[model samples]
Target: MFAQVRHQLCPDLAIDLGTHQTRVAVGGRGLILDEPSVVAVDSESRRILGGGAAVGRVAKQMIGRTPDGITAAYPIRGSVVHDFDLCEAMLGSFLRKTGRSKLGLKPRVLMTVPGAISPVERRAVTNAAERAGAGDVFLIEQSRAAAVGAGLPISEPIANWICQIGAGTTDIAVLSLGDIVVRRARRVAGEAFDEAIAAYLRREYSLKVGSRTAERIKHEIGSADPLDEELVVEVSGIDTAGAVPRKAVITSEDVREAIAPVLQIMTEELRATVESCDPELAADLADVGLVLSGGGAQLRRLPEYFERQLGVPVRLVDDPARVVIRGTALCVDHFRQWRPYFESAA
Candidate 1:
């Protein structure tokens, strides 16, 4: 009863702490905050810039462009907390932005984690959230969250496949009866695609580009399959050999070729995951197909690419990038029903 009243006064929060982005949603309210998972700090002091306010979108804008003595850092990497202090600070800042702190109650927080998170990593997440003013911290698997958010019939005795390709990791899982049966996670995701693009430019064009520029190129023209009418975009970078600025026209074909190897690896992992499942569950996948969610799901022709590669239909959920957070929010709203599925990091 006390917990219910406390929750009524200050609703719980659901957080999707991704490598490239962090999203927060209230128990009853929908998503309230979505920002890049970045923090700007003083290089020497290692203190956050702007009185600890240079976080999220502000700090993200400084990536690859910050002047000397100002460094932009990502506290989370590959869906895990890499720097505890920075992550706590970042999460605290985001929580304050939601105005829950003003209620003088520490809200219980439900956070999504990668399926293969280690014990130490799980503890780190719980500790960070507690230090960030959370009353209680719960963890949910990202793939399961994606399944729930995509509106999959996970409670039914059928297979529900989900592929959540985020900035730092890809979570693949087959869920049934509200539980995950087979799962796989990989570090190669959107960041890997950007790195592939950068490396390709450096090798073929002798051009040096930052991660932001590479990401821009990918969004502008990158593809997983051949297009009926190819596209091209102008790229500006430093000449690797000459140490001079240069510009080049890069085609969609080049981007596709650059990222194909990374995509191929993900495909193989997905195939292995499917093969590891029971024959009945595996066969069910052929009918229910795969659901794609996350920021990387927005990659052009990704669904088509997966469909052709896996011999299964691929469906991309609406607002794929927000799927995990949405699912976490749903869990928060129906905590009693979903509580059994949550793993208490504490």
Candidate 2:
């Protein structure tokens, strides 16, 4: 009775806890929160700043600019909770900010997890959400959620392929009859690309750059393929030898060259995953193609690049970044029916 009453008053919640960003959704409502999955805390005391609410965009902005007493960092890595306390604090703040706190009734949450996480890592996610004031947490695999969010006909007999290139990890899956037929997960993703850019700058220009700056450069000039005309952008960083600030112009081709290794790993793994699938399903992928979602899917010319190299059509889904969260929301809205589709978050 109490469960029913609480369900009536407060809707079920869904969360996509990506390494680079976190997104939240409520049943019967669309996306309610989207922000960088960052937290700022007192370095010595290990307490979240801003009255225990310094999370998301506010904390992300503090990265590389914090004082000696404070540190801003990501609580999650590769879609797994690296710092349980910080993850709880960050989720708590998002919950509060989105008006999810109930006086005594915690909201039930369904969180998406990467395909390759261990059981222990999965438990950490459940524990973090519970500690963050969630009740009856549920877990859905990330690729499965992305397929759902992309509105794939996974419930049908045909195969559907989904590739979610997130910040810390990339998950690819082939779904058929509402289940994963084959899947792959890799740790090298957006952050790896950023690292590659930084490394290239340091190697080629003697400029040492930070992740944020590298990300900006990637957004401005990075591409999966050569552009019609080479795109160049001005970037600033500290010179390695002089330890002085310097600026340099970089091109999209440079970024592509820098991140080639990481991209190659991802592409190889994707192909291997497809080859490992059932022959029938692998053949079906020719018709279904591949659906790209997640933050990394925004890389310029990514779809075209994949299609060209893999010999399979690739397309980005609408609102690619929110695909997992949207899938979680869909699960929350039809909890009874979808409950069987995911592992219980307990």
Candidate 3:
């Protein structure tokens, strides 16, 4: 049949165009691509370096270490397309890497976006994907994708609370009956935590480090709550006072202190979201509890921190980082059933 031949030529793709990372999944296949959302370009020409091959993991490594003529940049910021041309280029490269381009047919793509992006931002995502070799484009909110990815009973009458904390944004939502009831999206998340750590080092230790190094320190020792055995990591950075390389031993306690303000803001936001819910839904939430996903969900003791702050049961989903893409992929596999929830970007 023509449909079968078309399917063989080009299948559907589910893409999570995250601020920190980009993930892709095929309709009949699981995740096939996971890479940092980074691209290296010529400083003057603004052309993608290495004939467009300097992207993803390769470009991520060039950050904070690029030569004078080369720059590493993230085309997506806060889960929105910040640089249209670069985003198109980066996505095109990723699509080609998937080998779908070789079939000479554009694939239909389902992409996840933050719940709070403006109409213009929404269009930009579709435009970028279209220009990047997609035949048709569909958009879905990240929070909904996270809910589905976490295997929550979103179609039930009871409330399902999902908080997806990624690198640049946090999407908090309450869902029931396959739709969002109330949601909050904020630009504060993993990147803020990294910035806080970097600033703390600069202010408290007179050590200046790059974002990547700070992120490393965070992953190694960061915690929201006290650990049974606190961790310590040696960090290398430039001494602001002497302008020379130096090393400092930072503890989990220090990281917690540095990121406390950011965490406080997130906690307040979550509380506000809960308060915004109707009394009936709020009651349902109290019983069902919160489901946490995304990379930030892996923060040390984060579930315990939220439990103490929100006074509710908190559950972190398995493979938290891939939840959105996985859920989006699930939708792709069952497009007919999930079609009503998607906004057509074609």
Candidate 4:
């Protein structure tokens, strides 16, 4: 029945399995699903929610906001799936939604994988999608996806440097001829930024906060360095003792100091990556500088910090949040032409 047709033909899907989120674009019909990597399960029933309520923005809101009897979790971690069973279920939701719109087209997905995972890790991604109802799967590195999203000429000979700072990992790469010449993947990105903020608040303000609260603070007032005139924002959280409610006006400088070590490590990784690049590609980078893409790029002063450390120009992309997804869609749409640029399929 449905299985026969699914095995024979399916539309193509592009997935950005980021630490913070998983974005699915079906033949690039403009990102069919954009959801937190979280999945909610009814343990007693051992069943998943209806596809209608299991995917996309709705699922994101349920995070940290869900009620009892429904437990939530992220099947993916550090850009790789840690729980394939749950990952497949989550993917199935997106596939169902996409098929409803396309009138029954099973999709062959091209997913973005971190450059750091091993071949075994890569196979886990393909296996999860197949179990989730994918007819076929292709794996593209996160940096390559980001490069394409940033409009870097990866197919050409020029070296295009891309650094994707995401929720769970930062992928730094020097790309030429559509291949990664030098790259580094680290689990220091948006989540780390939030952690840095949390640590800073605890150390400086004696305030205890959850990761979500810190993420809000990072987005609202976090910076790599102090602004010309520091800005302040009122924050609400509990005191360290017995979770008493408290409020404070935390300044941008506080955030800057909290996230300093993270920024330094990120910039240092970029510098080291550049140092490892082939001379020709390194020379090419001089002209191209560095293009920052990913959720982490939105942090203030990041560009200046990298520019100073790498001694090269650094600029953030136009849309940082969806860069990886956009690039994934672009490749999935042109799978025939760009398929060669992806990693070796296991």
- Among these predictions, the greatest TM-score belongs to 1
Per-residue lDDT over 305-324 for candidate 1, one digit per residue giving the tens place of the 0 to 100 score: 99999999998999999999
- Local accuracy of candidate 4 as per-residue lDDT tens digits, 112-213: 888788888888888888777776677888898899898998878888899999988899998888778898999888889899898888878889888888
Candidate 2 error regions (>4 Å): 1-4, 61-68, 100-103
lDDT of 2 by residue, 1-346 (tens): 9877777777788999989889999888879999989888888888888887678988866755766788877899988999998899899889888684556778888999999988899889999998888888889999998998899999999999999999998999999998898889988888899999999999999999988899999998889988898899999999999999999999888999998888889889889878898889899998779899998889999998899879999999988888899888988898898988888634
CA-lDDT, candidates in order: 0.92, 0.88, 0.93, 0.81
Please report, as a residue range, the 10-residue window in candidate 1 with the lowest summed lDDT.
59-68
Instruction: State candidate 3's TM-score.
Output: 0.96
Candidate rank order under TM-score:
1, 3, 2, 4
The predicted structure with the larger lDDT, 1 or 4, is 1
User: Between prediction 1 and prediction 2, which has the larger TM-score?
Assistant: 1
User: Please, what are the lDDT tens digits per residue for candidate 3 over residues 300-335?
Assistant: 999999999988999999999999999999999998
Among all windows of ten consecutive residues in candidate 3, which has the lowest summed lDDT? 59-68
Q: State TM-scores per candidate.
A: 0.97, 0.95, 0.96, 0.90
C-alpha RMSD (angstroms) for model 1: 1.4
Assess candidate 3 and give its lDDT: 0.93
**Which whole-number lDDT from 0 to 100 does residue 191 have in model 2?**
89
